[model samples]
Every structure is written in structure tokens, then in C-alpha cells.
Target: MEMSSKLLEKAVSEMAHLPGIGRRTALRLVLHLLRQPQGQTESLADALLEFRTQIRQCKECHNISDAACCEICSSPKRDRSMVCVVEDIRDVMAIENTGHYRGLYHVLGGKISPMEGMGPHDLTIGSLVSKVKEGEIRELIFALSATMEGDTTNFYIYRQLEGLPVKLSTIARGIPVGDELEYADEVTLGRSIVQRIPFEGSLKG
Candidate 1:
């Protein structure tokens, strides 16, 4: 791609670095932004900067938040006894959109993947174990993707909770194996949550 301007080339390069965006799409976006009023571009830049600088992870669940705890974790209506474990904020958003789960969530940050060099220590697994050991969470629901790494992470956490008096469960197999929870349709995900089975069965499968 020959750039008429260095600034345009730089903008396209930066935009193309985003996931799922190619150089052409980035160039189109950059051109569109250039076509907009200067204040409009400034507002966009300001919003992005503010989000990058001001965003914080919820102290309780590790979900994205502006404060110490996320709104769901701080809410009185949420069922603190039931904690649903998920991969990241996108999974949290996906589950929240279903409106079927009124329980609290513990975001693991990511799954254990040896190829990616992301192990248990790289995630919030330790914090989750601490939350469970506090004896407040009675039921731990595994809502992670059905990938091998997801299973490994779940089993690792399950082992950590051995002898604890918490009931363990996983979302039903309505979600296809190797599929991410965030990609499942709301109805299917909701049903899976409602019909969750014992975590032991997941280990066997």
C-alpha cells in the first residue's frame, strides 16, 4: 500500500493492528475519520484515551469497571452464593445479556494454554480459589468454553477446591464442544445455564 501521507500511513498501521481488521479496512476507517469534522475525531480520540486510562478491573470479579467493584458484584440482587466462572469480560457480557443468571461471576481472565504460554498463574485462578475458600460461594458454575484448555483450567481449579463443601456444576452440552461461550446464542446459553449438570460429568467426558 503506497501512502500519500505519512500520518495516514501511521493511522492505518495502528488501526490495522486491531484484531479482525485488515489494512484495507483500517485505511477505510482512517479515511472516514479524516472526512469527519476535527472535533468529531478529537471526541473519538478522547473517548478511546479515557477508556484506556480510566478503566479498571473489578476488585471482586476482575471484570472491567470504573470503580473498585463492578455493578453486578456490588448489586444487592445478585446471588453471591452462586458464582459462575468465565474466561473474560466478553464472556461476562454474553452471560449478562441472557438475563437468566442472577448469580455473581468470577472472571478467570483466560484459559490455561501451554502453547500460548498462559498457565494457571497467568489467570485470576488464585483469587477465585480464595473466594471459594471464604465459604461464601456455595455453588461454583463452570461456564468456560469446551476447549481442551478450558477443560484443563476447570479441572485445575476443581482440584484446587478438593474437599471444599462447594457444589460444582458446568453449563450443559447445549454448547458445542470447542465452541466459545461468547459465541453461543442467548437462548441456548440461557438453557445451558438453567440445565447445568454436575462438574464430575464434565471431567468424565
Candidate 2:
């Protein structure tokens, strides 16, 4: 799309790079921003700048936070013995919305996708294994998606802690095959967490 102003064009180009946003949508957004109060636009820019510069990953779970540790990780009410392993903060948010899980979480950053060149070593799997080795975590729940890559990552972690005393379980099949945990409705996701099965049992099928 042709724009009269290079500033608007640049803004639209950057916005278009965001996922699910097209050039048209980005242009519309940029125009809307221009029409808004100058202070409002400045505030938006300031917030984004602060977020980009100040955001931190939770040291324990690797979830995004403003401080070294996320609120969930530092919460006193959370179940320290149960840790749900998820693909990322988005999955963590999805599971948290259900309110069914009261345990801690371990964000894997991403699944093991050989096609994408994502391996176990590329993720925070080492810290997770070390967490289990500490003997503080009693159950490690695999809350990753049901896709091949997700399953592969789960199995890989399982093998790592096979001899450890921690119990390994996976969310139930309430989530359909190849479905992402983030897209599932709250009811189904909550039920899956409530009715998780042993990791070994999942391997049989």
C-alpha cells in the first residue's frame, strides 16, 4: 500500500510483521494511532519500550515477568511438589485460566521440532531435570500439546528422569490429537489437568 508519509509506512511495515497482522490491518492500526491523542500514542510507545527493555524471565519456570521471579513462582499458595511442563508462557496462561491447576510450571520455551531445529538442549530442559533431581518436585505433569513434537519432548524428558523418584503424568486425551493446549476451551483443559494419566500409560498407545 502506498502511503504519503514514510513515518506511517515504516510504522505499518513494523506492525505488519506481527503475527496474524496483514499490511492492511497494520495500516489501519497506524492510521488509528495517528488519529488518537498524541499523549495516548506516546504512552503506548513508552509502555512497549519499557516492556521490551525491562521484561525478565522467571528464573525457576522461565515465564515472562517484570522481575527475576514471576508472581506465580513466588506465590506461597502454589503447590511446590507439582510442576506442569508447558511449551511456553502462552500455554501457561491457557492452563492458568482454567484455575484447575494449583501447582508450579516449567516453561520449555518450545517443543522439540526437528524440522525447526529445536532440540532438547536448546530448551530449559536441563534446569527442569535439575529441579527434579533436587527431589522437591513430586509429580511432573506434561502439559504440552498433543502433537508429535510435543510428545517427543515429553518422552525425552521422561527418559531423562526415568530413574528419578518423581512421578510422571500427562494431561488426559480430552484435548484432541494435534490440538494445542492454548486453543482448547477452559472446561476441556481443566478436565484434562484434573484427569491426567501416568506418563507410562500414555506411552503404551
Alpha-carbon runs more than 4 Å astray in model 1: 175-205
Model 2 residue pairs with clashes? none
Q: Model 1, range 19-120, lDDT digits (tens) per residue?
A: 999999999998998888899989989999999999999999999999999999999999999999999999999999988899999999999999999999
lDDT of 1 at 39: 94
TM-score of each: 0.84, 0.84
Root mean square deviation (Cα) for candidate 2: 6.8
lDDT of 1 at 49: 100
**For candidate 2, lDDT tens digit of each residue in 31-135?**
898888899889989999999999999999999998899999999999999999999999999999988899999999999999999998999999999999999
